[model samples]
Target: MRRRLSFFACLGVAVERVMTDNGGCYRSREFNAALAAEGVRHIYTRPYSPWQNGKVERMNRTLALEWQYGRAWDSEAGKASTLPAFIEHYNWGRPHSACGGAAAHAAHRRRKQPFGTQQLVIHAFRKSSISM
Candidate 1:
């Protein structure tokens, strides 16, 4: 838990909330307390509702396809040995459509901008620039 918090700090991310399935570890008092100390909130998905956690579910499916079965390994040890490289490739090199075509690592480093074309259009709409 300390390591996870430290990782987020190193990434300059103040994790406001996390959504996960109601797993035993996630529901544990110790885990919840640690997150609370960091001012983070936990949200649980309803049972058997993968769509409720759509992004994570899609990522899990992606990993199975791209890493687990993407290549033939001589042994579990071989796969484990190459896991770090695969992770690096996935985070830093691969462009994710869900991340607006940015690599995951790059996307994670970005902060939300207050102003954008969408925000500008919405501001105009609120001022009645266009009518229904």
Candidate 2:
């Protein structure tokens, strides 16, 4: 969670709040401390209520179907190696219905910043050795 927070910070995005299910990790003292240190509000969905976090749940489902179980991998390293490319394609190449048939980065660009600025940031991110 701290790493993700830092990544968003590097992207110049202020994360004011985070919503997650009532999972053990989210309830841990270390996680709460991290959120408190960052001054980010933590919200938990009602127990058994997946609808409260529908988008994340849907994404998890998609990831499971399309990536995790899509093919047989010879080793864990092989599977792990494909994640970054999958994420890149998912974010910048594939069209999403929720984004009005545009890629997620396109919708994010329209909503957040001009195309050139977003491209520059993404280019920098791609060039950097930062591993998520």
Candidate 3:
């Protein structure tokens, strides 16, 4: 939760609400009181409906692919220490197909809008025909 707060702060967005699963920590009265004090709305997803937070779920899949399956971390401590570094690389270095194959870091620098995979495939075909 603290990490989430820091992330939102870095992004310059005030979290007006929080959506969470029925985790014990989130369901605690203290946690709800805190949210109330901060005037941030709290939304709990229906059980078995994790897709309510699709973006986060997708990112978890990406993390599993990029780090959990691909990397070798022998111990918990090692994985914990490397997590921040991995997140930085994922946010800044990784190329997202949804973002037009451009590195996330480069997206902020470039002015052009992203082209989806279908657009890329069509563009490639057009280029080949023009060359022929």
Which of the numbered candidates is closest to the native, going by highest TM-score?
A: 2
Query: What lDDT tens digits, residue by residue, belong to model 3 across residues 1-132?
Result: 444554555655566777776767778898788778777788887989978866556666776677656677787576667766876776678888866898764765574543221111100011111111
Q: Candidate 3, after superposition: displacement of residue 78 in Å?
A: 1.3
What ranges in model 1 sit over 4 Å off?
105-132
Worst 10 residues of 1 by lDDT: 118-127
Model 1: per-residue lDDT, tens digit, 1-132?
666666656755556676767767778899789879888777788999979877666656666688778778788777767766875686578998967999855665574542221111000011121111
TM-score of each: 0.71, 0.77, 0.65
**Best-matching candidate per lDDT:** 2
Better of 1 and 2 by lDDT: 2
lDDT of each: 0.62, 0.71, 0.61
The alpha-carbon lDDT assigned to residue 126 of candidate 2 equals 21
TM-score head-to-head 1 vs 3, winner: 1
After TM-score superposition, the amount by which residue 53's alpha carbon in candidate 2 deviates from its true location, in angstroms, is: 0.7
Model 3 TM-score, 2 decimals = 0.65
lDDT of 3 at 84: 65
